[model samples]
Target: MTDKAGIHPKYFEYCYVAFVAFLLLSNIAATKLIEVPTPWTNLVFDGGAILFPLTYILGDVLTEVYGLARARKTIITGFALSILASLTFWLVQLAPPAADWHNQEAFEAVLGFVPRIVAASLGGFVVGQLLNSVVLARMKQRWGEKNMWTRLIGSTLVGEGADSLVFCTIAYYGIITGGTFLNYLIVGWAYKVAVEVVLLPLTYAVIGAIKRAEPAYSPQAWAQREAVRAAR
Candidate 1:
């Protein structure tokens, strides 16, 4: 009978697509390593770092608005899609090249990396996304309708730390050892958390707008409003 959740057709559907898009893109991007400079030093990170943090943010939005059950469903969907994407790439990599096709090596150099990286990402993602969603959902459970930022930031801190550690370890543990390997863990985790913190204002705005426009945000809120109306 009515349109919902701002200009979006269905916020959950939009969020889910965006979540999986970023997830798959980040996995592909992660095949290459990059260095970020600070006045103190240069930090090594994967290309995926640029886009991966947004997944957690989107995860938060899904949890905060639609609740944990649906958020987890979305995470599983993204996870399954990521596996599908990796398998698709692997299949392409295995296919025999045409006699004139000379880019098979290039294809192996690039898309061939997808299976391993995507596998590592999948491991870390399931662990981290679940942690992030559980933390936010639990916080919302306790605080009711207040203190959104606390839960969002807190969850990111927990989720990103675990995700970065698992991913870096799986992706580069034996390949890059000692201080450099450890640096990957710290930098990746800290960078993700920093991105989440820096974007808190925007996060607040998005969540607020969604809550206002989406009627199903909180069953308790809806119940209380209906109770007040009954009194009137």
Candidate 2:
């Protein structure tokens, strides 16, 4: 890879948009918990569990393609937006409803996130995403851009592990038993890692396509472009 100095600041805006979208949508979906019945037992998880893992995948893509600084900016952007959304929801819930608005209760039920839950969500997201980006960025520096699968899996394990543990503990500390909370954490982490594993092929393709389409900030690509410029 080339030096960071050579890489330009042109960002792939779509990735940032997708990252924020996934983050916000997951938080919205987390308001509900659903059960998945299996042969031996039922697997219970928050609705966000189904979608939250995608954020990590996108985080990986952002770091891998655009470098750590850009990924950090994207992560902070998502985090700020999530807090804004939560505050907006809270304010709307607190506002007086119109005379004919009988559905305020329903609306609050769907959108009114508790303060503890909001804290857990925001804290988990920032810590997990930063860890993910830092780990992958460091691993890429160590491994020289090879073995993407290893980096992805390893980083997700650490990142999702922290995310699940923090979010579950804070969000459901008294609501669920300790054993159940432990199960939730374990299952959530496993499910997230599994999603990334199953989607490895698709992730690879997307990463490759994005790298080809937007090679502006990639250090190695930047070096090549500069070499060609020198030759010209």
Candidate 3:
């Protein structure tokens, strides 16, 4: 269902749903920390870091095919649903546990969103994702299909940089400081960008499929859009 004249995407709903699902699940996973030992220093990050990069990839997919306006809408939708999930957990945490229910503590431990964490998650997501979309969209307009790889990597660098700084600073600045803080920030950012780069082939496949599947998507269509944007 669409009101637009030249746009009706077949697979966008799937992408949108997957984007929101990953966003929520990653937040849950972030509650758990991952540590691996090495001679130099242990690799440390919240579990969500493993899965969170997919959201940005999805953001790229959305912007690459659907446009930035749609990508921003999806980002906001994810933010709203995340808030709802957080509030729901807080409410359930407040409820008294049944005598038979022995897992309240576990539930709180895994599902709880402290104020700092909540602020960090929501703030970082909005800022990083919007930046990703905007940067990617602008790059696409300039290079079209000629520099797709550069567009993806360049956007990830800017977006992931902002996300790592905002999320770590708000969530762990005071508690973790000095060299350890720097490690967390650098490792988190590097890990995310590396993952996306590793998965570049898959991203290309997904984008190509969606571009072909969308009835209104074509190189000429996009070029016209670029012309329209320039005129405005």
Candidate 4:
């Protein structure tokens, strides 16, 4: 922990809360596809890509303000929450549908995740999120805790890379052609990184403002306890 230990600012806590919210929403939204036509080719990406990069921004703030251990806990919290969400979806889908319910087919179409894909998502989240927090914490230690863009984008490169490779490989490897799989990997990762790059200014502003406004009451342990509570 930094010398600023024991101080958990109010706005900073809100940031942490927002981080987890974005992460959960992003993962749930990722089940859908969004396609667009570029000048040279048509590109397909998940809607979640737009929001997932915000998690990176939150990771940067946590590492910069609270330190790595806390960020590590936060990452773990996210991973556990994601798994729970997946399981909840699975359970809900498994429960018998009402006789009058007419949206069973549509609901299954939207959320009927295969076991392999679920495993891939959970695994990728653990590896990628940990790497992201670790890398950001290390960079912050070396770089004097400034340069939001460098840390945010740098960590995203590593984190999103792990996430993309694991997700694409395990979830769609045999289902998609090698060429198409590679394309999905590239576009998915690239799109997420681009979100970070584009939000550099906003990230800087948010970090700066929060740092100035929030009191330094560290919630390193409290955050962990809350995460565990949510998981259970």
Per-residue CA lDDT of candidate 1, range 1-232, in tens? 1222222324678888899899999999999988778898779899999899999999999998887887898899989999999999999989999999999999998889888898889989999999999999999999987999999999999999889888998887787888888778898999899999999999889988888776554575567656667878
Evaluated at residue 53, the lDDT of candidate 3 is 96
**Candidate 4: segments with Cα more than 4 A from true spot:** 1-5, 114-118, 146-148, 217-232
Ranking by TM-score: 3, 1, 2, 4
TM-score of each: 0.89, 0.89, 0.90, 0.83
Q: Global CA lDDT of candidate 4, please?
A: 0.74
Backbone clashes in candidate 2 total: 0
* Model 2 lDDT tens row, 22-140: 88888888888777788976776898887789999999998998889888989889888888888888999999999988999898888886445667888888888888899999999
Candidate 3 per-residue lDDT over residues 49-148, each given as its tens digit: 8779999899999999888888888999999998888888889989999999999888877776554566788888988999999999999999887789
How many residue pairs clash per model? Answer: 0, 0, 0, 7
What TM-score would candidate 1 get against the native? 0.89
Model 4 / residue 170 / CA error / Å: 2.6
Question: lDDT of all predictions, in order shown?
Answer: 0.87, 0.83, 0.86, 0.74
lDDT of 4 by residue, 1-232 (tens): 2232344446555766777888778766766767688898777666667777778778877777767777777777777777787788888889999999989888787777534445676677778878888888788778875575788888989998998888777766786666666777899899878877887888788777776665553365557556667878
